[model samples]
Target: MTRKQRVLFLCRDNATLSILAEALLRELDGLHFDAFSAGLEPADRVHAAALGELRHGFSSLDLLNPKSWLEFTSEWAPEMDFVVTLCDESARVDVRAFHGTPKLRHWTLTPSAHGATHAIENAFWQILKRVEDFIAAERRPWPSSLKLPAVASCTTDACDLLLSGQ
Candidate 1:
């Protein structure tokens, strides 16, 4: 089976844009991708407004604690397939040194400079729109007669027994 794609969303802090991107992608089922978010330097907590915006469309369960990019390259490293940077500052640096050779993309958003409520919400929605477009593109169907393995399927003995004509 082909491996499921692993995507990491990054920003200066794992607080706003990265957090929302992770949550939004989770709500999109057909994309068949796993999402994670981290930062160069993390904050104490996710920004309250960002969390609230995410809650409107997704469950708050498994919400990420703020963490550094350093953690992803250590012994605890996750095998990443894509790495996306969501802000100008984080996008400008070289993340490959830490996240390995995952395909990298940048989606730059204006920073929440003054922390104005409406501005933050606007930025969130803008990012959300971009993410939606990305998911749609990724979900496009393969050509007919192509025999790709289902990477998302279970391989456990119980699953095998269930699928058998027993």
Candidate 2:
């Protein structure tokens, strides 16, 4: 079977944009992508409004949680095909664990940290829209005839290089 491409969304907080991006891709393009999210310095908890907005479409938001990027540097972390930074604060990230030089894309956004309720909700929806467009644009029909080996057995760098189309 063809393997799904893996994507890691990152930010400074991991509580809003990254979480929402991960959840949105998993819910909408689960067949094409394996999505994950993390932050450089994680917050104590995910933003309530982001969770509430996501719950409107997804059956469950159980997977959404604040996480640290350091977790992905471990050998046990999943090999990623793409690394995306969603907030300006985390636009420049070090991605050493991913196989090869995975595609790195950054989308900068401004968060009204202390702004009104509407601003926070707007950020959630805006981020969701950007993530949706990104995944949708990259989504493609897997070559039905192409046979790939089990992803678990591949070396981290090899897996990333293979996905990089090299």
For residues 75-105, write the lDDT of model 1, one tens digit per residue.
6688787788987777876756655578788
Model 2 CA lDDT for position 145: 88
How well does candidate 1 score on lDDT at residue 126?
76
The digit string of per-residue lDDT tens for model 2 on 47-67 reads 887787776769548888899
Candidate achieving the largest TM-score = 2
Model 1 residue 152 distance off true place after TM-score fit, in angstroms: 31
Clashing residue pair totals per candidate (backbone < 3 A) = 0, 0
TM per candidate: 0.75, 0.77
Off by over 4 Å in 1: 110-114, 140-166
Model 1 weakest lDDT span, ten residues long: 140-149
Which regions in candidate 2 have their CA more than 4 angstroms from the true location?
Answer: 110-116, 145-166
